[model samples]
Target: MFGDVMGMMGKIKETQQKIEETKQRLDTVLIDEQSNDGLLKVTLTANRTIKNVSVDDSLLEDKEQLEDYLVLVLNKAIEKATAVSEAELSAVAKDGMPNIPGLDMFS
Candidate 1:
């Protein structure tokens, strides 16, 4: 069964390569999201860290409204990022991982 052993080895190596590539991709991927009002936008890493946020100058006309809008927009942006990360991870994991999107690929 030497041929079977070699075939298994090759399959293992291919799976290992996909795992490494997905690990690298997930580590630094970021998603950008914008508010429907165009007043705020944010960038979030795949791991759910907010990298940056921007607000339009016009929103500052009302402080309380601006604050409320900021909170809503930030939450939306994070949600968008979470969706993006899940989609991407799903695509990558389709080749190997069968459990869930955020399962530990590197491990």
Candidate 2:
């Protein structure tokens, strides 16, 4: 019984390490989004760090419109990045998890 517990503990530690590695990898995974009119564009990492933003001259003419565009495009980018981050992290965690009876958290 102690052996099993020790093995499980090792597996959990391995999983935690993998999770951290995956998070670092995700920082390189980029998600791009643009306004429907293509006037505003954004690029961000799966970690939700903004990398770049491009705004059209027309958008610059209207402060309110630019803000609206930024909101919409940034939200879309964040959503995509969040989805990718979650999927990658979940896969790593689920794959690393030891099969323990009565713990079907991943399922």
Candidate 3:
């Protein structure tokens, strides 16, 4: 019984390490989104940090359109980043969990 407890503790520590590594990897992941017309682009990391925004010089003259473009691109970038983050975390969760009797349904 003590051996089982010790084994579980070791697995928990290993899972914690993997979680930290996943977070670090998320910081390095870059997700980009561009407008359909290619006039605007936004880049973000899986950690949801905006990395860059680019807009066509032609759009600068039209303030209203530029605002729209910026908003649209930013939203797309954030959405994609969120999806990527979810997928990564799900993978980590699956990896970190150990199979146990009658508990597989929870995953």
Q: For each candidate, C-alpha RMSD in Å?
A: 6.2, 0.6, 1.9
- Give the winner by lDDT: 2 or 3: 2
Q: Positional deviation of 67 in candidate 3, in angstroms?
A: 2.0
**TM-score comparison, 1 vs 3, better candidate:** 3
Across 1-107, the per-residue lDDT of candidate 3 in tens digits comes to 78877887788688888888898899999998899999988888998998888889999999999998988888888888889888887777677766666767427
- What lDDT does candidate 1 reach at residue 14? 72
Question: Ten residues in a row with the worst lDDT in model 1?
Answer: 92-101
Best by lDDT: 2
The predicted structure with the larger TM-score, 1 or 2, is 2
What is candidate 2's lDDT per residue for 29-98, written digit by digit as tens? 9999999999999999999999999999988899999998999999999999999999999999899999
Candidate 2 runs further than 4 Å off: none
Off by over 4 Å in 3: 100-106
lDDT of 2 at 93: 89
What lDDT score goes with residue 13 in model 3?
A: 83
